[model samples]
Each structure stands twice: as structure tokens, then as C-alpha cells.
Target chain A: MTLKIKKTDYIVITAILVWGLVGFWFNVQGAGAAEHKYATIYVQNEQVAELSLSEADSYEYSFDFGPENEHTALVEVEEGRIRMLPLEDDICPRHICSHTGWIEYTYEKIVCLPNQIMVVFNESSRGTTREDLDGVTY
Target chain B: MQPTTLKMRNRLNYLTYLAVLITFAVVIHTVEAALPLPMPVPGVRLGLANVITILALVLFGLRSGLLIAVVRSILGSLFIGGLFGFGFWLSITAGVTSCLVMGLVLVFQKRGLVSLVSVSVIGAAAHNLTQLGMASLIIANPDLLRGYYPLLLLLSIPTGLFTGITAHYLEDVTRRMIIKSGPGAGQ
Candidate 1:
């Protein structure tokens, strides 16, 4: 039997490919354009902590996270790189944040959905939070 | 044989097909979960089990296809130890939503407006976007939408095409097989 590939099928496929490539182009252009110098931690959409990632900077801090601030999260930064350690009472099943290791680029981020934690890298030292890189095509 | 007996036999035959489809879906789901994806973004997958979904929907009906999709997600998550977890919820929501979208597309497909590949592509995109939206809602992080959704959208195109092509060909093979072996063969 012959496979029936109609005109609409070609149109749909082409539309999806073009849309996808456009989104990809925007993402590529937005990322890695600035020199990331800080790692900002956000929990439940609230900015909790910001740490510098300068070569001479080194720090390890345990910050309270979660809805009630009951869970403790540790972060370590050394030599212009930063990483998030697992929680003391790690309720997160995946621990994807810790598995992500270190992120030094402006485009890289560590997100732990289970614990509602996000570590985002930014270029500016403080203020001017770069609006989380736009292009929200779904 | 009594008429009721023949009816019962037919019902059993139909149930068996659905059962086999569900089993195939579960196996593919679990195996795909275990395989490593080259993409760094989380929640991006090949969605290979969609082939079984398309097969069931095209051959059996929408209800059976939806049944397979939900059951496969539930059982597959159970096997992978992600039951009721964030990923589990993501899988369930995305799976059901995509199944419904494909079922809707199947209506147009019957009218010759689109092909199986088009149906599959639309369903795959629905699944990916739904998962991202659900994840964003669960975490209360709208930043994820602006940060990661675009990249995932870009990646879904190729992966959707891959599963769509596979489902298209498999649908053909299975149709021929059913015609040869099914009870309606003489008719």
C-alpha cells in the first residue's frame, strides 16, 4: 500500500521545523554573551542568596530553603565556579542540582524542581538581574 | 456455538489486543527512561512509546489509545521508582494531554486532511510543552519558561519527526497484519 502523505502534512512539518530553528537561534544568541561573575540562588521565586565567582573568592555557606525554611542547602564556590551540594535532609529524589556539578557560564543553571531551588549564573555583580533570558515560545 | 459465546470471544479478542498494546507501551517507556539522552536539558526524551500510542489509536480507537498512554506512564514510572514524584506527575500529565491531542488530530486524519506523521508531530510537541508548563507550575518558577522552554521546543522537532516516521510505518505494517489475520478477513 502507498503511504499517504498529504499537502497539510508537509506544511505542518515545515512550520514546526522553522519555528524550532527560530527559537534555537534566539537562545544561542542570548546565551554566553556576557561574562558571568555571580551565582544567584532562587527558591520559590524569591532571591535568597548571591555569591561572587571571582578567581580569588572562595566560600561555603548553608542557607535555609523550602517553604517553611526548614531544609538546609549548601553551596560552594571556588575559583570562578560554583556548585550546589545536596541538602542535609535531602527530600529531593533526583538531586539533579548536585548532579549538575559546577556551572561557570552565564547560560548554565542548576534547577532542582523537587525542592523548588534554582541557581542561576549572571554577568553583573549585583542589581541588573538580566531578566532570565527571554524567548518563551512553547 | 451460541451467539453469546461468539460475542464473548470477540470481546476477549479485542481485550487481548489492548492488553498486548499496553504491555508493549510499558516496555518501551521503561527502556527509553533507562537510556541516556545526549541533551543536557532535563525532561527531553525521544518519546518512542508514542509509536504504540499511535498504533492503538489508529487501529482500536481513542479510548483504547488513552488507556494505554495512562497505564504505560503509571506502570513505567513504578518500574523506574519515580512513582508520585515530580517526574511521574510530569509523565502522566504530558502523556494524557498528548494522547488527547493526537486523538483529535486522528479525526482530521480520517478525513484525509493530514498524515500519521503530522498527527504524531503535533502530539509530541504537546507532550513536551505540557511537561514544561507543568514543571513550571509545580515549582512556582516562571523563570523556567523564559530560561529553558525555548530550547526544549527547538529539540522537540527532530525527536518528534523520528517517532512520527516510526509510527507511520508501523501503522502500515500492523494494518496489513490485522487485515490478514482478523475475523473480518473473509469479508
Candidate 2:
């Protein structure tokens, strides 16, 4: 029997190829972070603080969801990048966020589900006119 | 042969076929789950279980294919203690969506609009999209789709093609065996 290629086959193949290409492009764009200069922290989807990555600094933030549901993360800014340092004190089950080191890309995020906290990098601090803000501001 | 006895035998055959297909699917699912992947992507898998689903759809009909998909997913989740969690919901939704898409393609196949491989690819894509939609809703992050869904779609193609080829061969062999056994063997 001869194997026949139908119109639907071509459509399916083209769709998959296009999807893969688009996904790959986004991933590449997200990983390019040389131009990013700020890291913003959010607690429960609310913006808590924004820190500049133009200089080196370190700080700690805590989220208290309830009496026994508090969580803390050590945020460090160095080498034009921001990262959450993995600490033994973290009570989260999987320390994946802490293990994700040095996120410099604008789209990169460090999320702590248990504490409902997210740290994301941005090109500039939100609602700010200047790109050179050096200190953390709420 | 008596008509009533033949009818009863045919019913028995169908029930037996369904049970066997479900068992095969569950076994394949569990085994594939145990295999290690290069990455820890949540929805990524070889999808060997779809082999049975496609076989049932091609050899029997839409209802049998849907029944096998539903039963296999539910039973697999129950066996793995994922009956009431995010994983269970994703699996059931993906399974049902893929089966329905494949069934639709099969309807079109009657008019030679698509081949088995195309049907499998569409089903696989549908499965990934359904899972991505469910995951986005659960996490309340539409960004998840933007970030990860494309990779899942790209992976589905090769996996779908492999399962489709396997199902095609298995269906042919089983069909021939049934015909050779007796006129009533496949009834």
C-alpha cells in the first residue's frame, strides 16, 4: 500500500512547527537580561518593594500569611543581578525558588508558593521615571 | 449456532476487549510514569498509553475509544492515589479532549480528509492545550501558557506520531487475528 499525505497532515505539522518556533523565540527573549536593571518583590500579588540591581545589596523579606504560615527569603543583588539565597531557615517544602540563582532577565521570576511571594526582574522599577534608582522603595 | 447464544458471545467479546484495552493503557501509563525524563516538565511524557486509545478508536468505534480513555484515566489515577488532585484533573481533561478530537478526526477519515497520523497529532495537540488551559486556571497565571505551552506542543508531535504508528500496526495485527480465529471472534 502506498502511504498518502493529506492536507490535514500538512496543517498539523505546520501548526506544531510554528508553535515550537514561537515558544523558542520567547524563551530566548526572556533569557536575554543584560538590559534589565531592577528587581521587584510582590506579596500576595501586591507590590511590596522594588530594588535596583545597578549596585550590590542584600536584604531579607518576610511574608506572614498566618501564625504558622510565615516565610522569609534572603534577597541579594550583586553583579548586576538579583537572586534569592537558599537558607536553612526556609520552611518551604521544595526550595526550588532559592535554588534558582541570580535572575538578571526582565522576565525571570522567583516564586514562593507557600508564602505567596514573588520576586521578578524588570527593566526599571514600576511607575518610576528614572532608571537609576539605587535603593529599595515601597 | 443459536442467535441468542451468538449475541451473548458478541457482548462478552466486546466487554473482554474493553477490559483488556483498559488494562494495557493503565499499565503503559504507570510504566511510562516511572521512566525518567531529561527534564522535569510537568506535562511531558512519552504518552505510550495513547497507543491503546487509538487502537480502540480505529478498531472498534468512537464510544469504545471514549470509554477506554475515561476508564483508563480514572483507574490510573486511583491506582496512583491521584484521584482528587491537580494531576487527576489534568489527566482526565486531557484524555477526554484528545479522545474527542481523535473521534472527530476519525469521522473525517471516512471521507479521506485525514490519515491516522494526522488524527493522532491533532489529538496530542488537543491534550496539551487542555492541560495548559487547566494549569493556567489552577495557578491563576495566564503567563504559564505563554512560557511553557509551546514546548509542550512541540514535544507532542513526535510522541503522537510514534503512538499512532504503533497503534496502526497493532490494530492491523489484531484485526487479522480476529478474522483468522473465526467469523464471530471480533463480534
Candidate 3:
């Protein structure tokens, strides 16, 4: 016997799939929503603003570009701060670094692919259980 | 002589078609590597060979389509295995699962036409999820899969549609010209 899948049945299935996708997308974003735990220590040329994590999972730290954007340092979580330059392109026009914003505590990504500047915020990815790299002199 | 002549020609033609399908799979695997997107994932490859697998199902049969998926995965990896790292296991599992899902539809369900568009769309859509599930098993990060699941589904929509359409067009032309024309046209 020929299986007759009605138009309505297929539509319902498609709708269910789309709804499932929408639900999953929101979950990832919400779960990924770090609490305001990441504090940015902005270092522009000679200027510096020390931002620290007052608590875990906190997110969003900001810095001023001073209308003369140059360079900055980023310390993800407990790792030592590393200086990074922003990627310049017509696409990434926002300049995530210069704008008043906050990012995660660790695995902090500074992707300037075209300019070859990629300072990632690899906070927890760095073996947290292992001794700090700074302390290991070997 | 008539029956034997037809049988030998048929076998050779089948082998030739399988060879051509493998070539297509290899080309797609290479493209997946060369065209690297800036997406956050460590390894993100399109299941383009799935087009061939779906085509095999629609044109030949479920078993043949399953064969295409298996052969392509093994041969494609042999050529471009470097980029995948440990993720090969994940892709293979998901690839097989998705193919089986569609192949089952073809084998068991008579009415649902195994169009290249439908089969690969279903196959490619599930490919990433199945692979991600495999990765989660290795990384011990089930929650990570849960987190990325939603975004992956969103991305699959347009990509799946495009790939499905391409597969559909290519298969229709090739089936019309090649498979449909071969000696076994009546049988």
C-alpha cells in the first residue's frame, strides 16, 4: 500500500522541527550568557584601566578608544594579560575592543583575522587544574 | 551470448558509476578543507558527499546509497584525514546514522520519493548533530552539545536547502543521462 503523507502532516512536522531549532538556539545563548564576571583592564598606549572579576561568571567590561584607538591588553580569567591589536575591516566595524563593552572572563577572543591579530580569551581552556603557566619556569 | 554480453556490460557500468561517485566525494572533502570559514568550531566541514549518497538512494536503491556513504567516508578520510583530527569518529557515526535514516525511508516507505533534495537535506541536517554528539562523548561535555544544538539547527536551514537543491539538480541530470540510460533500463 502506498503511504500517503498528507500536506498538513508534513507541514506540522516542518513546523515542529523549526520550533525545536528555535528553542535550542535560545538555550545555547541563555546558557552561554556569562554573568557580569569578566572585568577588562584596558591599556591604550600609555593609559590603563584595571578591571577584575569581582565574582565568577560575571561578564561585560568596557574601555574608551578616546577617538584615538591604538592597542590594549586582555587578561582572561586568572591568566596573565596579553596585549592585542584589533582586526580592521569593513565587516567588523563595531571595533569590539574600543567600544564600551564586556566579554567573557576566559577564552577571550580578539579576532582581527585580516590584520593577523587574534588574541583569544582562552580562560578556562588553559588547564585550570594545572599549575599556572607563569609560575612554571621550566 | 546475448544474456552474458548484457550482464558483463552491466557489471562494468556499475563499477564505473561507483568510481565516479567516489571521485565526487573526494573533491567535496577537499573543498571542505580549502574553504575554511571563521566559525568558532575547531573543525567544521560540510557533508557535501551526502549529495552523492542521496543520489545513489534515489536512482539505484537503498543498499547502493548506503554503500556510497560508507565508501565515500572511508576514501575521503584517507585523502584528507589531517584536518579532522579525532572528529572522524563523530562524523562517521553521524554520517552512517543520517544515511540509515534516509535509506530506511527509501526502503520501508514506498510513497516518500527519495529525491536527492529530500534525502541529503535530511542527511546533512542531522550530520552535524550526530557528529557533535560523538564529540561530546569524547570531550565529556554533554552540556556543550546541548548549548550548540540550537545554533546548529538554525544554520542548517539555508545550508541544507542549498545543498539539497544542488544535489537534486545534479542527480536529476546525471540520472537522466547516465543511470537511466544504462543497459539495465528495463530491469
lDDT scores in order: 0.82, 0.76, 0.57
Tens digit per residue, CA lDDT, model 1, A30-65: 655533388889888889888878777888977897
Candidate 3 Cα misplacement greater than 4 A, ranges: A1-13, A16-20, A25-138, B1-3, B38-44, B83-85, B107-116, B179-181, B184-187
TM-score of chain B for predicted candidate 3? 0.82
Candidate 1 chain B least-lDDT 10 residues: B1-10
Candidate ranking under lDDT, highest first, comes to 1, 2, 3
Answer with 2 or 3, whichever has the higher TM-score: 2
Error of 1 at B173 (Å): 2.0
| TM-score for the A-chain in each candidate structure | 0.61, 0.52, 0.27
- The best-first sequence of candidates by DockQ reads 2, 1, 3
Candidate 2 has which clashing residue pairs, if any? none
lDDT of 3 by residue, B33-120 (tens): 5687877754555556677777777767777777777666666677777435564576568768887877765553346444334444
Reference-based TM-score of each model = 0.65, 0.65, 0.58
- Model 1, residue pairs in steric clash: none
- For A21-77, candidate 3 gives per-residue lDDT tens digits of 787766746644443332234232232444444333233333433345453333333
Q: Candidate 1 versus the native: TM-score?
A: 0.65
Tens digit per residue, CA lDDT, model 2, B48-142: 89989998998889899988888888888888776968888888889999999999988887689877788888788889889899988887666
Docking class of 3: incorrect
Measured by TM-score, the strongest candidate is 2
TM-score of chain A of 2: 0.52
Model 1 lDDT, residue A3, Cα: 69
